[model samples]
Target: MSVPPRLSMATLPSAAGAGMRAPRIDPAALDIGIVHLGIGAFHRAHQAVYTEDALAAAGESDWGICGVTQRSAHVRDQLVPQDGLYTVLQRGTGAREPRLVGSVRQVLATTEDDVVARLADPAVRVVTLTVTEKGYRLDRHGEPDLRDAGVRADLAGHAGAGHRPRTVVGTLVSALARRRAGHGRGLSLVSCDNLPGNGSVLRKLVTGFCAALPAPGGEDLAAWVAREVSFPSTVVDRMVPTTRSGDRDEIARTFGVTDAAVVVAEPFRQWVVQDDFAAGRPAWDRAGALLTADVTPYEAVKLRLLNAAHSLLAYTGALAGHETIAAAVADPELAAAAAALMVHDASPTLRPPAGLELSGYCDAVLRRFANPALGHRTLQVAADGSLKLPIRVLGTVRDRLAAGTEPTWAALAVAAWMVLLVRGRTDDDRVLAVEDPMLGHLRTQLGRLCDRPRPHDAARIVAVLLGVTEIFGDDLPAHPVFRDLLTAHVARLLTPTPRRPSRSAGS
Candidate 1:
């Protein structure tokens, strides 16, 4: 076996032959008008693809992306060597045509001063971020965690106090201050993360960051941000699993090129964005993006229906020793619970986004989950359940409980998370690696399971977990009906024999 030629702009034209679509827009003619904060596979597979398609369709040459890798230098390394060109293997389509995306013109490390320079650039009117939930360093109320070490470090560095900004919130604030001083143009801050009310939440975090800053400078900057910046909430749906080596191997075999930054995504993709840009922006609507005045209805629909069911299956699937989401949906009991979550528990809490029929949307969400080619790991989805459940499952639980009904499937999802938290493995002895920022807190409360291993100990276990006010809040634990259902679900899920879940006490 010989080494394949690396995929780069110079080699791009050759890489696109049969079974592949080359870049439709010339990468050289484009300008970097957008700076994307997180250049991970999700951004590459979802937003970057949309931008590339938009550029091709709308004939826009000014919206090219300057990708910034937030965590490690790995993404920068892969993309920089390839001249910011990567492959998207759109799986589950049957046609198997990989797309060579060229909208990302360059890559930068978060530590690089050029990141701030790029942010302050007047030409860069839009900044998009897909940094995951934990990246926000938010408190339970969705405000910036001022005590967070990264936030603190970044704050101390603010306004040139001799410290480089650390956290994304801090970094963004610092960059905004620079932008305030130079260019002084209005900008659009679009959040592509799976956060509830992401735009408003981001505004709160920014204002919170501003408030935490030292006195007058903070007030002045916050005022400027309030006037000049717009954070638009969005509902982004796509199943992009961690790109494995086999995906790279397939890309190499089919395209005859080596792309370390290849992203394997399911064919189904949707983006519903709020059309509230502070400056001129991409015509994403031209590329199948739904740009509207309000993203709330759409956000609620996606969060409660699609995302809620996804988290439910992740926890239950991990406990059942099913590796991927597809395997989880294949299970008769888990599949039913997932559908019940969307149809029975969550749907009642949401108004169908205009033109979206609830029945079809629910079916489509599960169908997407059952795609074997996606390889979305249960544990990957299950990670950060502490952050995700509040956004995905708890809202439905609260709404259902308020509506005088039992949120059976939602409670079961929460119970599965608790079970995974306590046991950390399946009955088959496969380790379920579920990560959470609040793991130690949950483990401390759930330690009672080790004390009383009896079957009847489910009540105490449920109490401690529910008492997590940060997650459940003050109202949920006080409700007898909700508590009883969780206790019942936890007890049954704890048993060695897995059984089909019976419906809760009420609708």
Candidate 2:
């Protein structure tokens, strides 16, 4: 038995792709107009889809993306071979059959100078990023951490000819300097990451970078940035799971083409963007995206209800030995907790966005999580708790605290995260792999207890982790009620559990 040819322009026409849909425009002819940093699965499954729809609807091809991989060349390796063609399988109700997404016209490693050139390119008006939270290299204050060696090195090295700075902010500031020298044209720098006021956060980082520059030059760059760049916040919603090898094999069998960059997503997708572009952008509005003056209202609703609840489910479900989110939410206890967290704790924190009924919205979020076909992993969502919890749930905790209330459900979520960090295994004794940027700091603080897990140490665990002010800040760790709740939940979670009946992902 021979393997099918790789999916590409040449193989696409002849391939027996069942109900396969190709990009509407001639991809080769489309000029690159947008440069996306952190070309991960989430970006491909969300923004790329919306961009293609915008292109198709408007019959414009100028917005083809040149995806730059920030961390590694893996995405470039997967995409470049296939000419930037990948299959997107929408997995739930009313899902359109697998389609070849061609919006990604080119793929490049961050090391490639083409990234800087493209960023400075006059034709390219917008720069979008799906780089996860830690990519920003932010300090506890949600500002660029100048103390970072990478940042300091990049700032120093950026002045040299043919120098490639190591960090994302360094690269952007360098490109903006070049753009100012050459085109002097305005551009939109959109932050599509999960952060409240992300646009402003990005703006601060960029300007802060400019300020970090030595004297006259720094002041000059800051002025130019003020006049030339627009950082737009966005609220992007989509649940895209890590593609299994089985998914690629099935694609090869069903579509008769080998694809290294296949992505599986739920049918529902959304993008609510702040309409503050310096240069014009894609007509994403035509493709079900909301281009609005303020994204805060929508962003808050999603973060508090959907995203916060997701963290809870991931932490609790993973501990309960559930492999997938669907199974996690199906547990009666976990489901009830998730519902109460959303409606009782998180919802009250938000100034509800218009036209979004709180009850239905929360219900819809659980339904989306319960989509067995998507198979979003409990551990996958649980990864990077240090970064995610701050953006997703901590704000709600803060708000509730401000309103003179104890955020019980939110504390449980945080405590579950603490247990995952301190205990290091599931209830049935499966070694749950803990992956977080702060893993080093967490372990160092937790001391010998990392080796010997103990529920009795819950008080110490809560005390130490909360002391990592970057995640919790000074107030949360000092809050007696918060400390008590976290200690209680951590102790409870750390206690041994009786083995329950096995639950399949579909159940």
Candidate 3:
């Protein structure tokens, strides 16, 4: 069977005639000076766009990106044929704006030696990562999980024995080791993940990973890494939903070209970065990126208010039978709950940057969530609850309780997750296949309670789940106020509601 043709460099001229915009810079003329790991849609729509704009503003061609796919070759498959070109479709209430992004000059799979070589290159002064929360292999205490099989293997000096590094930490260690051996200069490692203090956290993890290595010169290598590398924390925000088949069809229809590497995102975007680098770096600030000496204030506001509210709505919205965030926020009850979560529960916990209006920020977040064209699904955001809850919801809950606040909205968010787990399906009647790493443990624990006579007992469910230290930690369950509020909220969630009175009957 003949495969359909996709948009490639050879077809750019023809595609441009059909009203598609191409990259302003010559992609072939650009050189890769930055290596990015976990090159997913978010990276494409967020950092890549920023980098492209930055390059254009500076009129420089040396800072192009080499994107490394950590797990699969899905991105590489789509981008290689197109000569590292892709489309970004910014969807808003008014119209869909599509443009070609050209910052990425090369793509490589994680297993390829080119990834390490790129990292070891002296010319590559910057490395960026979007490897997500779980990619760090952090344990409950926010430290590297030494027991992880990959961690154990990497620490056992597998890389020295010609074995490929399996984890991100291991890969970094290997790359840095190669660079150190080659007498390469220092470089900046920018982390664009959603975690708070991401740079410091990654530094600790990498150093600790090195400390555990049984290989010779481990201590020296760790010392060299401490002296050489700089990890700068950053907060990245954008609503880039997972691309679907329909998106591909729409791109073909609208652009008159079949773009396999097209990414769609909401119009809202923000990037706040700590202006710290070991070597020279791109002028990202020129592209409207906020570079600050302290990104903590921005990071805290985003994580607690925006991210926590997102999690609150995701679970609750799923329980309320809403598929997309826009659809969910359209429901007055859910929208009100989300607002309450942000203003009452999350806002008080935040020490926002000076002149940053908490109320306006909350309003803007809700408006972004209601962008119908983005089609950001509740289930997609709801996935990886075990990994997400600690940063997104639990932190706010802890802060509120510490401040002698009730945390009613935070409790409701937790209760909603429990309710979804017990129900085993969304309110929309779709099977809720919990996409968490601890799925097995969650099922076993919930199963024990569910097998009892009163399986849906809210008190019992909350007690058991809260006791799971991996998710809730040891301190929360001990707090009587938090426990009681959580129990009350869970009970309310389990209870059936009374039907509303009909207008006809009242008349």
Candidate 4:
């Protein structure tokens, strides 16, 4: 494959064609003050866009971002040639609106020594993260799993042994140690991941990592972190599809410029943050961010309702023969099922922010999911079930059961995931490669069930899956109501039905 032409600052002056949307601010004049980890599509379309707008609104140049990719050099490969500039294509039902985002002043891979130096810089007052759930390296109990080889290695002071930190937890710990050794300036660490109490969770992991360190001055580092760093939780909402080659090609063709880091997302975006930054932050509120005293209510609404419903549609929609979320929700059956899941099964468990209408929120979410131009793939969202189900689906199930309500739709969603695992294909016969971290373990357990005399029996299959304590806690499997409901749904899904006649029949 040929490499597309590079998009660089030198080309920006002449690149303003009918398709190009140039940044309003001068990228060269900006100073790096925010270090953002995980430079992925979501961050580009959501937080980066917000930061750009905030900077433009505040008329400030000191809050430019230094984007660091945690594991891969893919982002670095894409953005470095572009001079840390990229286009965000906002696609709705109408034409795509492309905008240039210049908030990222630099991009660095985790292996670079400059990552630590940049993090420790007094000019960098804030560190924001979009590392996904598994990136935290937390155990099932939400503590730092020091048993992980990487965490153990970092705690053993291998960070100074010339090897790069292996995990996000380790990387953050190393960076904080450097900061403490240097200026010891205060900074805010914001978590934009979907996990509940993400800030608190990260604080615990980082502090725990510090406590377990065998190095000298470990206790002092922990104490300094406790006093100087603030972990503020945030709720970020946006639908950014994994960019495909076709998206890049379209951007090149339309914009008359080659942008390797172009990202496509829906027009909608939202950010709700806890107002607890230790150091000052960008005027994100000027760019429509919600700075609140508490972000719990907002987080709860988005997680239990929107995210849970998306998971439901992902699994069931994949099984129901739809490729994209828009196509899936376009099906009346799937759409109604999703609506019911949100309104009945998930809504009762939510405590939304004051003056937030639950029904209207659900309706808006459905509309967002139905935006065809977004091209959000079902399989993309359906991956990582073993990590996602606990927070997305199971919590609502547990909550509803405690409130004396049946989580019928939620159970159906879980049952669909089990069926997908067993069948290994969508209803339209598209093959599904299991993509969970526990893929190997799940396949082994699933193979054991198939070895039983009645492999197709729903009760046996459901029982086996529910027994996986990592995904479903031990208590959920023992609860009679939840167990029986899940079993029934799985049974209905497993039951064979008559196939519809082919379109060419009776020709």
Candidate 5:
């Protein structure tokens, strides 16, 4: 496998274009056929790296990425100066290294007005998305929220001649409609988000969007989408810390060229995608991807255990006054608490394969969370609580309640949620938004509840929020077990901890 020239270092060895001796590959050789949405750091560090590796290993260059950002020109400004090339810094427990990835041939801001027309092109055969779960604009049943103002607006835009859709689902619907009308080949819509059954979820959202369109060709396009477009669910893993101001100098030093958009991630990476595609795909298997028959089990293990635990640490640790993931893990109390929650509570919900014990997995997760070098933040994990909790915590809660099983960890996690949501303040005076989907209702209740006993009021507030079918999809209030458990945790959190004197003794 030849390193792409633009990425090859000039200072290394020689095969006339080997190692450091190899000149950068010509950018013209790479085709920008991939229209990727949500040009975020995770997408760059994970999917982009794999795409670059696949192209390099196979000696093929037809699948360069044309990144599309729904908001802001930050990435475009950063990558344009470097000619769409950027460095990926992979830091692990013991090693730190950088690789120049040239898979992205161009970047575009969909806000540019002309971007929708570009997406309609037949050349863009694959549209990948990392637009977070909220980007799906899903209703409580995990269905697409078509009535959302943004979704409605985008769909309306698609109906107007020469107008372009903005949301990814809208853009996909409009593109498929155009392709069907133009007799063009259909494209695959691959979702690289962390949601479970992501491929199916994306398919449903696109279908939902198409169903909303009034054009005569809309149903025809839906039929085309059903027959021509494939949605492959994937399980992706990588710890990409947000890029900081210091990353610029670090990237410049490593690549010998500056890249403001350079992404930093831990060395670990994994992708298990279902082996199904409507249009052809890159030789990703050549780059070590797991092309499985069904990504269900794999996706479940990652999403339920790995991501769910991450969220647990984020919410519970933030409430416990920890800042970074490593700091939270350093506390033996917190680490044990999280491990017990996973191993005893949530792991039963997942049916992992033989020889893959949940206990061992929990151990590994604890170590990963404790990686001081990584510096992953608690808030970063906690940021999207409204979208995350239902998948991470409530799934276990629902299963336990149905089976008449005691949900200790799930209850504690819900308790942690209340503590996290109620205060919106840190010891350092940092303000949290408590940006749950039910924020408006919670605030309205909080105004009156402060006068009453906090725990009683907290339980009521939680009951209302959890009962929102659009979020939790269940009448949690109906379950006495859930209500009681949440109430208990909320009581623990509101109670003051006993103080201890230092080695010098009390004054």
Candidate 6:
């Protein structure tokens, strides 16, 4: 395999027009058929690489992506200067490897107001999203909040102005509306997020938005969207840690050019998608993507074990004052606690896909999380607990209750969460700014429990916190056993560990 020639960003055509050589790629060699909603680092390192490999394997160019940004033009400004070619630095300890990725063909600033016109383009057969889970604007109940201020504003403004909205769900709704009015068929909408059943979540959000609209043919359009559009469930895995300033300079030094939007990530990547598409999709399977008939088992495996464990490490590590995923995993105590949580409680609840080995999968996850080269921040994973925790951890809680089993580790984690919430600060909170939508609420909840010193008081606090059915998907307060375990574990996590570890409860 020959490496593609590295072109200097200063030599691209855009820079050429400004009396500098413009970094340029032959756009004719690639077609822009896929429009991505969030032009972020994770998308660049993961999906873009998969798409590039797919195109290279099939010798086709119709799958290049048109990246879109909602709020800022930072990515646009950076990529346009580089002619959409940038280095993806795969960093390992003492080894920083860079690869030039060419999957992005063009980019649009969704805030430009006229971006909807581009969405109606006939050439576009698919619209994918890597927008973080918070972008969905889901209510505390985990359901789409079309009434969210941003959602309402975007919908009203875009529909009234004959333009597209910036939010992924709004943009897709606007595009589906336009397509229905003209071409009568729309593109598939794929959500590549960490949420369980993200595809269905997206579909519901879009459909609900359409259903709420006061217009003729809204139901018809919704039906067409349901029938004509395909929302494929996917489990995307990659560790693209937030790039540091030193990383930026290193990328420029290695590639011999400046790229403001260069993404740095670890070398691991995995994408599992349900092979359900309305129009069609890139040959991602050729690039080792597992395109299965059903993604539930695979999703369960990732969501329950990988994502759940990540979340546990996030909060627990933050409480323990660890900075990164690698650092947290290095703690024998933390590592032992997390491994015990997975092996004893979470892993048993997940049904692996056929021919999939649960133990092997967990070992891989543990190794990946322990990679000292990846500076994946604890706060980054811990930031969105209001949106993440219910899906990632509470499922195991519910499953344990259903089987009449004791959920000690899950309870302990929740206890840790409540304790962290009560503190109103992360580990080293004075130096770091941690933000979550429910931070204020968490603080309020914790304040109410300050005077109570009884076990039942802790149980009440845990019940009240987890009782948000929209977030937890079930009424967690009703389970006495769960509340008891959570209360007990919260007590344990708050109690100072003064000695070597005891045998894990569920283990």
Q: By TM-score, who's the top model here? A: 2
Q: What tens digits encode model 6's per-residue C-alpha lDDT throughout 272-329?
A: 9888988889999998899988888888888888888887887777777777888778
TM-score pick, better of 4 and 6 = 4
Model 6 TM-score relative to the real fold: 0.88
Candidate 1 regions exceeding 4 Å error are 93-96, 448-454, 498-507
Q: What is the lDDT of residue 73 in candidate 1?
A: 87
RMSD of each: 3.7, 1.3, 3.7, 3.2, 5.1, 5.7
Predicted candidate 3 versus true structure: per-residue lDDT over 40-134, tens digit per residue: 99999999999988888888888999999998888899899988888888788655467888889889998764577788888899999999898
Q: lDDT per residue, candidate 4, 369-482, as tens digits?
A: 988777788878888888888888898999888999889999988988887777767554557765677777776887765432232488888888899997898789998898
Query: Which sections of candidate 6 miss by over 4 Å?
Result: 1-28, 93-96, 140-143, 155-158, 162-166, 426-432, 448-460, 496-507
**Top of the candidates by lDDT:** 2
lDDT of 2 by residue, 1-507 (tens): 889889998888755346578776678888998999999999999999999999989989789999999988999999998999998988887788888888999898986545788788899999999889889998987667988888988888877887887898998998899988887987999999888899999999999889888999888988999988999999999999999998899889987899999999999999999989998999999999999999999999998899999999999999998999999999999999999999999988878777889999999999998889988899999999999998898988898888989999999999999988887788888899889998988899889877767789889888889999889887898888889999999988888778796475887
- Candidate 6's displacement at residue 180, Å, is 1.7
Off by over 4 Å in 5: 1-26, 94-96, 253-256, 427-430, 450-456, 498-507
**What is the TM-score of candidate 3?**
0.94
Candidate 5, position 390, lDDT: 75
State in Å the error of residue 196, model 5.
Answer: 1.8
lDDT of 4 at 379: 79
What's the lDDT for all of these models? 0.87, 0.89, 0.83, 0.83, 0.72, 0.74
**What are the per-residue Cα lDDT tens digits for candidate 5 across 15-60?**
2222211213445588877889888899888888788778877788
Give per-residue lDDT, candidate 3, residue 397. Answer: 88
Per-residue error (Å), model 2, residue 411? 0.4
On the 0 to 100 scale, the lDDT of residue 99 in model 3 is 80
Q: Write the per-residue lDDT of candidate 1 for residues 417-440, one digit (tens) a residue.
A: 988888788756566667999888
Cα-lDDT of candidate 6 = 0.74
Error of 4 at 435 (Å): 0.8
TM-score of 5: 0.90
